[model samples]
Target: MKSLTQGAHHIGLTVADLEKSAAFFTELLGWNEVARNEQYPAVFVSDGTVMLTLWAVKQEPSVAFDRKSNIGLHHVAIRVPEDSALDQIHQKLLAHGVEVEFAPEPLNGGPMRHMMCYEPSGIRLEFIWPGE
Candidate 1:
């Protein structure tokens, strides 16, 4: 096996609305698609260093809310550039008719902002700044 120091790379998740979901990440997070394989039903997006991939899965929106059976996947938190960016994200989410997971707040539990939503298949997603 490769050494543990090799480090981790990307995280992949299957989503219902591939284009819309990809837009949600790229447009909101400032990522761009660099690679794709339709046969795999997935595409990779990156910002020079970090890479994110979303797999296309055909499913209904209700899937995002139910997890009692498998608890399949919880939530994915993508770190944004700053603490202030979340406010802008929240507004955008509203414009798009998405709900907030809990109101946005500071990482230290103070008052700030963050973007939180469930994808078309009910998988959890988040956008926030990394801890101080």
Candidate 2:
């Protein structure tokens, strides 16, 4: 059978604050808000290639994300163009008062370097750069 899936279209994440999460991605990743829905309480942002959808849940209580215990997403990793870009983002996230899990470092003693952090809504995000 022919492959039905082409590639990832978008990633939908549940956030406590729609505007805050939207702003975070826009500022950090340079994504632009392309669409929004008040009824669904979602904001869609894209970096001219991939789209990320942030869904707001005001009525429900927020639950902290636990990668080990949770059955869902562990983290979302985005690729950076260069090794220095990872550090650049790390600094910006710190300036924005965003929580940084750790500074950028070599991944598993390999050429790849990565840094992990949490978005405003408590979702773990990773920025990685694979060495040349």
Q: How much lDDT does each candidate structure score?
A: 0.70, 0.90
Model 2 agreement with the true structure over 1-132: per-residue lDDT tens digits:
999998789999999888999999897778899999999989999878778999997676677778998799999988888999999999999999999999999998968999999999889999999886
lDDT of 1 by residue, 1-132 (tens): 877675438878877777877887677657789888888788788866667788887555434445566655557676777776777777777777776675577655654346577655457777777644
Candidate 2: clashing residue pairs, number? 0
Q: Provide the lDDT at 120 for model 2.
A: 92
Which pairs clash in the backbone of model 2? Answer: none
Shift of residue 89 alpha carbon in model 2, Å? 0.2
**Candidate 1 lDDT trough over 10 residues, lowest sum:** 58-67
- Alpha-carbon deviation at 68 in model 2, angstroms: 1.8
In model 2, the Cα lDDT at residue 15 comes to 91
